[model samples]
Target: MGRTGGKGLSLARRLYTSRILGLVLGLLCVSVAMYPLDPPAWVWAVMLFNGLVWPHLAYQWARRAKVPYHAEHRNLLIDAFLGGFWVAAMHFNPLPSATTISMMAMNNVAIGGARFLLAGAAAQLLGVGVGLVVFAPALVPMTTPAQLYACLPLLMLYPLALGWICFRQAYTLGLHKRELLALSRTDSLTGLLNHGAWKDQLEVEFERCKRQQTGAAIALIDIDHFKAINDTYGHVAGDIVLRQLSKMLKQNLRMADVAGRYGGDEFCVILPDLPLFNAVQAMEALRERFSFLVYEQNPALKVSLSIGLAALDPAQGDATRWLDDADQALYEAKAGGRNRVICCSDDKPRREVFDSV
Candidate 1:
């Protein structure tokens, strides 16, 4: 019931505005046909209630029900029944009767597709039966000019309104799908690409550099003693430190550079179309800039980065190997000291370590 209600409640709400428009237009169409036949005072009163009051009442009924979706379905069948009843009461006038039945069918199909259409048809048949018992079966074959004009507003306008509603729903669902996809790829804390998304882009960068025989580089950055920061300061303070690093990455990196939170206490960057020398310089500048950031919460709280860089190696077959190379350089940076940039080169046997004083 809970699951059913979750789906059903929205159905009722979505239908509410459509119901108001459809029923009001249908009333105008049905009323014209019934006018010629001279319905009794009670019939006229019933028509008014169905046209004006029933839409609101049906909405409330479905909305308040435990299984709102089921309640709304019931409300739609009732709508079909009323449409049939009106057709019979009007002596089955051609234009108005067809308009009323088609409008109801359109509404039913939009709600539940073919199955609901069949169910609505059955309800309409039952309504016709009851209406026949009350008013006696009679056929009015010809449609007057006035009746045709009355039905025109319903025939033309209601479909446009319903179509627009469906369009709006489709557009909104598409927007939500795009947003969800972005959230899935992003790290919630750092707002950088998540581990998986970053790796995927690394693969693309590796292929691009290898195929073109162009130089690029990948960097692994570790927040020095990050766990100690959480242990010394609160986790909240540790989180702020992490966010600070991400902000600096965005500010320092070029648009072509891809950055991501590789894992706990570690970030990664891919510098496309950049030589090994320039990549090292960029990492060094970033390292220096980050070392100076001061937190307002803890003015004395200071932090630094350990960076390891690996240039694109055509000899390296896969992205993981490239990542592993950077990881090894990062290990060396941490081993050397807490605040410096270390460049790992495929061309050289000895790695270059830049220790900032």
Candidate 2:
């Protein structure tokens, strides 16, 4: 598969420091075991280069690769191979050998989970086989005092570095998830909660009213003659009008009010812990202020709103019935006149009109 942008590069950068630290420390662990063996001049030189120089070369290799993520994985396998080679070079001294291989296992699991761990193990075995051929492999079960102390830095500090890296990765993922959730709930056009989110809030409000015996109101608003506006003055102009209404809703409503785009040219608001008469006054004020907003696209292009309101009735069964009442009142308002607020009632007329001045 083709590598996506920067994924491999990011992995390489994250591992670079840990790689340098581990290799240098591993050199110490291996050197103590190799000392008694009286290894030749070339073997000591190779050890120094592998410990002090190889990390920089590996970083450059990954950075320059066309697919940095894939390149980094190859680098990890190479490290595993070298780790096993050193264990054999040390003649498999018990403490140093276990320490070296276990650290390599931790890194493989941290980078790519179990699958990569197994792959690293295979690479290590191959390295051990090559070492046996090249160096006449021998096993030394005892760990002297010097070898034990040399292994301590790699054993103690490498895991701490690896652990910190893992924690940072998890934290970054958490932040991305939160951003995605916000985008999912919000309407792109008006920057308000979308229809479904608002409706969810409505259901919560409904249950609250029923449980606490508190008052709340629902308002369903429609832009009057919206299609005519779009036809006469382009969809862009119509969109400007919609945005203007949404801006007014956000600015005028109280913090407790839940407003959302009910879907194209229509909007909804839930006023919690508010009385019926107050909600009507609030809607009327909004209608009047919105009527006076002059559009920059066409100064002559005037806009108006028709809103329908329904207050909480303890007798109401669910959120749907409450919304239906407001929808019916909105229909009544449009039938009565273009610009007005209609309040749904249980009385004889079943609708009360509040005309715009």
Candidate 3:
């Protein structure tokens, strides 16, 4: 799997493991508590120790790891382990007092807090349901109706705490995803769309133009004598030249224009709702501006670009054809002598060319 896919899978595995662990701990706690001092105290103590320490170990590992942390899983696992340990600790005491029951109720409080804080409404309901399942043996069989009535406050408390906790966790996760996506799609050096992101945007724009019957123009641009500049001034100067040219292109284009570095010394622009003639004119102006711009310590140095322009055809409905046409035009511009804009129509074959290879 790719890095992103692996990261996503790891996140899912952690969440699934946490949930299963919670279910197991809940079952273990309730089953152990049901015995009512039938077993040795050391057995219960051992169980408690394992329950508490194991989840803490996992939680700490997740916190330290480079992988993205899912707060819901962390909180749930911690609460589940703690709740199990609390019940086991009570089992070790063998005291059938109100204090024992209160301690069990407090276990529910901790579970509720983790659930509500990290998982929201669904977690609140889940905490209440699971708590009821764990504590049912003690609460449901009470001889007095008043004793059952007194449990209401704790019951309501679980859901409310769970809801609050989960809501905050959800918001934080959302913000993190948004920031990660932006960074992934952006070019770190040029502050433009990266090649992958630019391709995605182009496909979407192509579909939109096809559906809306809107004209779209694409220009393939290359910096003239880029290697000579790099060889003469050093890589740092080359990078500065690229950055300045990117800035100039961005500033010169319309607000709706989308530009990206296709590869080293090559750039592409997607102009939506633009005609072929206007795109040619725009490329001409850009070439003129670039020719006049001075490079560092090279006063006599002249810079020029060769541009190929292609306009989308609604009848054809093929984005690839537009790019192919632009590529042919770019070849023609280079052949006819560098530093000029060439359209697809300008590269048509002569009458006698049909006989030649």
Count of clashes, each model? 1, 1, 10
The predicted structure with the larger lDDT, 1 or 3, is 1
Q: How accurate is candidate 1 locally (lDDT)?
A: 0.91
Which lDDT tens digits does candidate 3 get at residues 193-292?
A: 7777877878888899888978788888888788998888778777877787788889999999999887888888898898777887788888888878
Off by over 4 Å in 2: 1-7, 345-349
Ranking by lDDT: 1, 2, 3
Error of 3 at 6 (Å): 20
What would the per-residue lDDT of candidate 1 be over residues 1-357, giving only the tens digit for each residue?
Answer: 323355588778788998899989988998888888888899989999999999999988887787888899999999999888888888889899999999999999998999999999999999999999999789999999999999999999999989988998889989999999899999999999999999999999999889999999999999998999999998999999999999999998999999999999999999999999999999999998888999999888889999999998888989899999999999999998769889888798689989997
Write one digit per residue (lDDT tens) for candidate 2, span 1-357: 443356578788889989998888888989988999899999999899999999999988888888888889999999999888888888899999999999999999999999999999999998888788879868888999999999999999999888988888888889999988878888988988899999999999999888998888999999999999999999999988888888999999999999999998899999999988899999999999999998876999988899999988877899999999999888888888869999986333457789876
- Pairs in steric clash, model 3: 116-162, 116-163, 116-165, 116-166, 117-165, 117-166, 118-165, 118-166, 119-166, 120-166
Which regions of candidate 1 deviate over 4 angstroms? 1-7, 208-214, 346-350
TM value for model 1: 0.91
Clashes of 2: 1
In model 3, where do residues sit more than 4 Å from their true spots?
A: 1-161, 295-302, 315-317, 345-357
